[model samples]
Target: MMRLRFLRPPGARPEKEFLARCLQCGQCAQVCIFDCIKMRTGFNPFTSGTPEISPRDAPCHLCMRCSAICPSDALEDVSIEESKMGYAKLDRKLCHTWKGFIICRSCYERCPLKATAMVLEKGIYPAITDRCVGCGVCEHVCPEQAIVTIPTRFVT
Candidate 1:
């Protein structure tokens, strides 16, 4: 079966290690101030109840509170720069600014790591940089739906 593409909380360990270490305790979900973290719902015993973030529905703010409260150490306590959530892929063809339809900074302006993660190319088009931690704010805020956040777990 194809697994759903979803991001783990910030500072999450690798997929395998994260699953093994996750206690399904729901603490991470409970502490999320943005309410972006949701426990996977289903009968799959192994993955059910695990915290997952659906960026388009609600992007993580990278507050790091969930990691701080996790008793199992599944999500490490790391700085915003070290979160490694994933990376945002921008489809310029669909971006208003990139296409020269209008000047839009929705993604660039909303990015938590503004100048580092997302940049304005030629003072117009939005560009994703390697420093992006893929918190998904870009994806969530893009009016043109031009940004997609590829979770780190699915990178390989």
Candidate 2:
């Protein structure tokens, strides 16, 4: 099977486990404060109603409320610091700041984990760090489309 890449809500298990464990109850979507979580669409029986976050539409705030109310533990109640929904990768060649065409700070300014997940190199150009949780805010805010948030969905 061709592995599909998509960001799950924080606390989601590996792909196989998440599909098996998720009840598709929509509880996680109900409790999301940032309204980032949305039920998966399409007719795939293996993935219907599973909560996902598309940072371009809305970015997760790292609030663990969705996990806390999960009756089936499909979304584990994990610490915000440990959340790894996805990671942001910068294409510096396409970046306005890096290219010196513009001093755009869109990604840096919008990063939820600013200074930790996204930082300025040499106090100017933005760089992604280890602390990045791949929340996709940078991807949403990048004016030059220089950022692509890489989802961390693990497949078996």
Q: Go through the candidates in order and give each one's C-alpha lDDT.
A: 0.91, 0.84
Best by TM-score: 1
Q: Write the residue-wise lDDT of candidate 2 on 46-118 in tens digits.
A: 8878888887778787788998999999778888767788788999999999999789998898787899888
User: What TM-score would you give candidate 1 relative to the actual structure?
Assistant: 0.96
**lDDT: worst 10-residue window of model 2:** 1-10
Q: Model 2: how far is 117 from its true place, Å?
A: 1.1
lDDT (Cα, tens digit) per residue for candidate 1, span 1-156:
324878999999988889999999999999999999999888998999999999989999999999999999999999999899999999989998889879989888888899988888788878999999989999999998999999997443
Regions more than 4 Å wrong, model 1? 1-3, 154-156
The estimated TM-scores of all candidates read 0.96, 0.91
Where's the lowest-lDDT run of ten residues in candidate 1?
1-10
